[model samples]
Target: MLAFSKLTKSQASYLFSFGIVFIIYLISYIISPFTSNDTPFYTLIGRSILQDHVLPYKYIFDHKPFFSFVLYGVWDALMPIKTGMFTLLALCCAAGAATVASSIWKTNRFLVFFILITTGAAFKMLSGNTGVLQIFFQILVLYLLQYPSFLRIILSGVITAFAVNINYLTAECLSLPIIFLLYHNKKIIFNIFFFIFGVFSGLFILFSPYLYSDPLALIEYFQQQKQFLAAYSPSFTTRLFTVIKLFCYVLFFIPVLYVWVQQNIFQKQERIDPNSILLGLWFVSGLIASCISGYPFEYYYILWFFPITIMIAQIIKKPEKNFKWFFMPIAILTLFSVVDSTINNIIKYRNIHAIDYVKMASLTKGGSVLNIRALQTHFYMADLKNFDPYLFKEHIDIAFGSRAAAHYMHDLEQKPLSVLLPYQGCEIGAVEATVCHYLHENYQKIYEVKIVKLSGKIDHFSFELYKRKSGA
Candidate 1:
């Protein structure tokens, strides 16, 4: 306690902020460690990359760029598979808390407290996706650019490059340098040169494996990425509705918009704060980036959490009399939403717990298992290996069409072990037509159990395990 007393106020504030954030993350991890499919998928890829010492896409399949896997790879290297993800989660929250605390520690103490708590709650909803690292690096880049220096500007570019590699959706943040370049008056030319140089250097380092090991592979990767996007791109109506639906999730920003109207219009301030402009730009860019995919996954909204939190903090620091009425109710509602979502996620993932790994392992005899629209955690827990390249089932039919389905059927012919399928109303006929046909002909259903689903038409669905028939 004497050592604690010796620390400065800012230092104490940072520790307190970190403690709150880390504890929130810890509780979320304990109740629902794997909140979404993304957690197990990314963690499994990370584990494979660390153990095999090669990029994992060649073995497993994922369209996410390389750096997120690299971060996970490093995390998985230091700890065992089951718990390594929690350590990463803890570290990410710690890093995010430090970033938040460092940026606002000297400002209004209440604002600092508010941002830290909200950011912690927001991070809990990330569910260990690449968005976790991607958003962190993007926020760090913005923080660095918030006060540009010779080194800080260059570092910002490099960090943004890392963010882009972690998740290509972060490319929207690349425009942020333009905002800084306009505001920065000193050594503009040198800043431009340095930023570009840093970006190139970061890219070179990230792609070095393909650069040196197999140059042709880089070209192939881009081609594959292009084809993948083209295959899955939704129509205009889908994208439009998606944008409208997601916008409702961010109504807390109405207060920020209200503040902006007051400052720019009602009061007619001679000069607007550049930092306000910067924050607004970053928030809008994140929204645009998320909209580009057209898949209405709620996890994508994780990008909005930090910027919105900071904007609200700015409001609270010097709130207007009328702004309080708007902000307080919205803040309360947002808090309720965060708590409600966390509870729902915990309940949703608890359903995945119905998969009994001991029975699965016994049924498969520790052999390769083909999982179709099933939880990936089963493979990770059972230490099972997959012989086929089509490890990922999503978009396989859309992206690769008949050929991919044919290949999956061909793998079923080998029939190394059990086949796991989502039990849709106990009628295998209703599932993917081609695969359903093959499974019925070749495999015999051994077990089926009810699995709860939170966000679908039915509250419960069945999960089934199938073993290959003898002499067939």
Candidate 2:
């Protein structure tokens, strides 16, 4: 321990980075047992790869690129889907945080604190979003920007390509400003060649088995992305809030801008780091992409926050002692906001607790289940398509809220086995209502099953098993 403490700054930094990463891993593992809709979806996809070698497109409904499938590789190696995904998420978050910490350490300590606070809040708020992997790749790009060695350039290009795979939005967020800067600096020839090589390599990996079979499929995949963007819209209130939210997001960069302006006004040729430029571009590009994307979710905006935090830290080298007073309130508010939002979401979507219902449903062996207000059960069944072949083979049927069932079932291949349960009084036009309507239509065919009490007072729980009559 004495010898370790006496190590050089570089050695100490490396150890600190490793320690922080380990802590993140521990936190993620602790939270893994409690599941969510998004997590199970990733798990199900990972499990599918282990069971079936094919990449799903039409069946899964998510247009995520091949980088996400890298998680599948990790899952395959790790064995359990939840453990693999959480582990990967934890590692990515750590790597991203470390990149920021290391980049800013030489520049400013106060900026580092702000970066830590904002990043911590962002991580906690968007815990299960899987956007962290893309953010990590973005940070890597920033880290590589100043190096400019052949190796670093190649690696940065590869990281940028990988970012596209996780979410095309990442590419959209990081690409324009990077290209613009490259062009303005008259590095177009190099940029074009590098970009082409990266794109080709990325496509080769993305479409390995099917590249020769049908290249049009990859083109169609991108075309669908455009359609998705076109179709998205924000609610009226959300639209108004989006503008205010963007202003708040911009505050993360104020320090950096202040420093840049001050230096320019004084004619001081402050040696501009290439990494700082890359981070500025990343933040600017991401902000523009989020704005144009129209139906902006808070998680989508988070990809920009990390890079901006790093930039701000770089700008404010040694803040005044009194500066802490102002920073403390902002940090506290950010923490409280994230915590409050997370708790409210958990309460609203307690579907994470519905894992018990999933286990119960799995035990029933593909039988029709009368789910009360549990629409997540159907999504879980969809996700478990990789796990339970019997259910996949038999088509696990569900009858829930009218809107949910109608929405989910419209795309389902088979008609529901039976819809006998009635919508409870608290629910409006719910599964119970749908079941009541079904019962009214086919009175002689269906029978009711046991009703159970659930956690919430307003939502009474029940399960009814239904079998189709042979003649009908």
Question: Candidates' TM-scores?
Answer: 0.82, 0.69
**lDDT tens string, model 1, 23-111?**
56446655654565566666677767678755646666677777877876676666554543653564565357445534632244345
Residue pairs in collision within model 2? 111-313, 400-431, 401-430, 401-431, 402-430, 422-432, 423-432, 423-433
Candidate 2 yields a Cα-based lDDT of 0.50
lDDT of each: 0.65, 0.50
Off by over 4 Å in 1: 1-29, 79-91, 94-126, 146-150, 177-179, 260-270, 402-404, 424-434, 452-461, 470-472
Cα misplacement distance, residue 453 of candidate 1 (Å): 5.5
Off by over 4 Å in 2: 1-29, 32-36, 69-88, 100-119, 122-126, 149-155, 180-188, 212-229, 233-240, 249-267, 315-317, 341-355, 363-383, 386-427, 431-436, 439-472
Question: How well is each residue in 215-263 modelled by candidate 2, as lDDT tens digits?
Answer: 7766766675555444434567777677677777666446455554454
Q: Between which residue pairs do clashes occur in model 1?
A: none
